[model samples]
Target: MPIADLLDRFRPGASVYLPGATGESLALAQALAADPDRLRGVEVTSCLLPGMNGVDYAGLAPDARLTVFMLPAATRESFAQGRVRLLPLAYSAIARHIAAAAFDVAIAHVAPPDAGGRASFGIAADFSPIAWNAARQRIAIVNPHMPSMRRGSSIALAEADLVVELDGPLVEVAPARPDATARAIAGRVAALIPHGAAVQVGIGGAPAALWAALGDHRGLRLRSGLASEELLALADRGALASDGHVAGIAAGSEGFYRTLADRDLIRFADTRETHDAGRIGREERFFAANSALEVDLFGQVNLEWQGGRPVSGAGGAPDFAAAGIGSPGGRSITMLPATAKGGTISRIVARLSSPSVSLPRNLADVVVTEHGVADLRHASLDARAEALIAIADPTMRDVLAEQWRSLRTAMA
Candidate 1:
């Protein structure tokens, strides 16, 4: 079906699911933003996409509501007051919640029309399929610019009610090379990574560096989220080879997508299978590497904040951590640099900023920083505090100590 004709099917107060980081259609988002009153709420995957804007409905409608999974509520600066709302949920439950008729409309992207009349969902496949089925109406911003993902589930173009065909670079988020500090932490975290483990590594600098360093290791397999450029490199270089790489999507440079086209090295799996704990726990040596905003004295991890604003979404961090630590020989490691902003912000804090993402200290086993690693499993809060402080940036040690003392006294 032609795209413009399909878009006319949507009614006001539509619960539309926008494409996430990879398949995001900026044109569609702008179109929706232009008519904010038509949308009751917009559901998004995350707010951290760089250079991409106009998705959040701030000025478009003063009364429109937004439903996001674990991202902070939108502020007036970004969105209108009372326009943003948050749905607190674990990554595991996001699909189920959406599938149960949680939204009225959904927005996504599809590949160019194929001979079979089926177009792939491209890279952002996690909860999208679930939402697409649940929405009363579905709108797809068809883009030939996106690499036609040969893997994962395919969506039938004949079924969608709205389709907008446009050609432009879908938003690209390139993984950054870790700095010296992050590299040191990644190395310590990598030391704990064992062979034949099904691992889930989070996005950003530390995981990218860890992916590069894993070149020396062999026989490591992945049974987690999407395969990034560094991970595909490991498979290509023979450092890491999965019996099969299981994931819902893939995001990286043009080179990364090219490597994914290789049938032998990459095979995409549905989220129901990839993120399921029962399925992942069967793997013998599961390992997960994730980032953190701050690790408190008692080993809590907050991956959702920056300068008091929520910069990330609650992705598969908790799900992968639980599966990795619960596996027979699995290990879950949280890696982070000791500080941010050139010594102004301490990555290790006495307390989490309001709105905690990862709670329950026992869930995480190892926390790594530039200075060293802190194994927090089965340890007391006081003991965990000591170990966490030990690995914090040296320059911030005194400040942490003072903060810790105050917190301790307050608890007393």
Candidate 2:
């Protein structure tokens, strides 16, 4: 059927699900945006990542509403105007929410069917399966450029459900080249992970540098929520224990996606399996590395909310951190630059700028900054303050110490 015909099928006030991660159907999203009349009075639900997928679904039509777990830059305006509904759910909880929403239509961007009549998710295996099951109808905009993979998530391709064929490249994010500060933190974090350890790292320069720093380690495995382009280089340098890794979604450049598809290097999983603490803890030497906006003396971490609004989401940070903490032989590692805003502000302070249960003190087994590392797992309140202060930016140390003293005086 024609793409126009599919757009015409949408009823006013209907609920729709747009797949997140690389499975997002840009063709459909663009069509809906171009033809606002089709999306008016419709409710759109998605988990569009912060850095990717900049379409403003809620703004497509005044009556349309977007419900999402992430508060990316694109949605900030809509959210403030009451057009977007922000769901403060963990990465795993969002999956459960999707199963219950029961959207009227689900748009799936996929690779063409293989010889066996199967379409794989290619780089995205995050939420398509759940979205498909919860929707009344599923429409696949088959893209030939979308790589077909032997591993990761796949669904049976049915000709009857094929609505339109679109030719476009899937979204790609270039790997962030680490700067000196990122490299320093990465080096320290890398030293903490022993050989043969399993690690989960979030995206960004610190992670990119950490991957490069681990080139000499052997028997290392990846058990992560996300896989990026760095995995390609790590594999090339023989840093990984095996070619097969467990990742919920692969987000990176076109070259990396193609390489991942060609090599079939990872097993795609959903948030449930990837973030389950028990399952994650079963693996020995599991380390979850996450970033934080700030850390208090007690080590409460924050990944979301900045400048009076949310710039990010909790995502899988808490999920993986909890798993690493519970794993008897594993540890949770939190890495951040010691300062922000060109050294004008400190990231480690007497108190977090905004704390809302992102990650508790217990999850902060080890905190690494460019200056040094703070092993907070076995430390007391004062000891944690001391260790954290030691790792803080040298310029901010005296001020942080004074603040800590003031806090203690008030408590006494």
TM-score per prediction, in order, is 0.86, 0.96
lDDT of 1 at 226: 68
Candidate 1, residues 107-147, lDDT tens digits: the string is: 66777767898877776677677777777777766788666
- Candidate 1 error regions (>4 Å): 33-54, 61-63, 70-76, 139-141, 162-164, 262-264, 355-357, 395-412
Off by over 4 Å in 2: 159-162
lDDT of 2 by residue, 164-189 (tens): 78887688777788999999999999
True-vs-predicted CA distance for residue 206, candidate 2, Å = 0.8
Backbone clashes under 3 angstroms, per model: 8, 0
Residue clash pairs of candidate 1: 3-163, 6-162, 15-105, 16-105, 17-106, 17-107, 58-79, 197-285
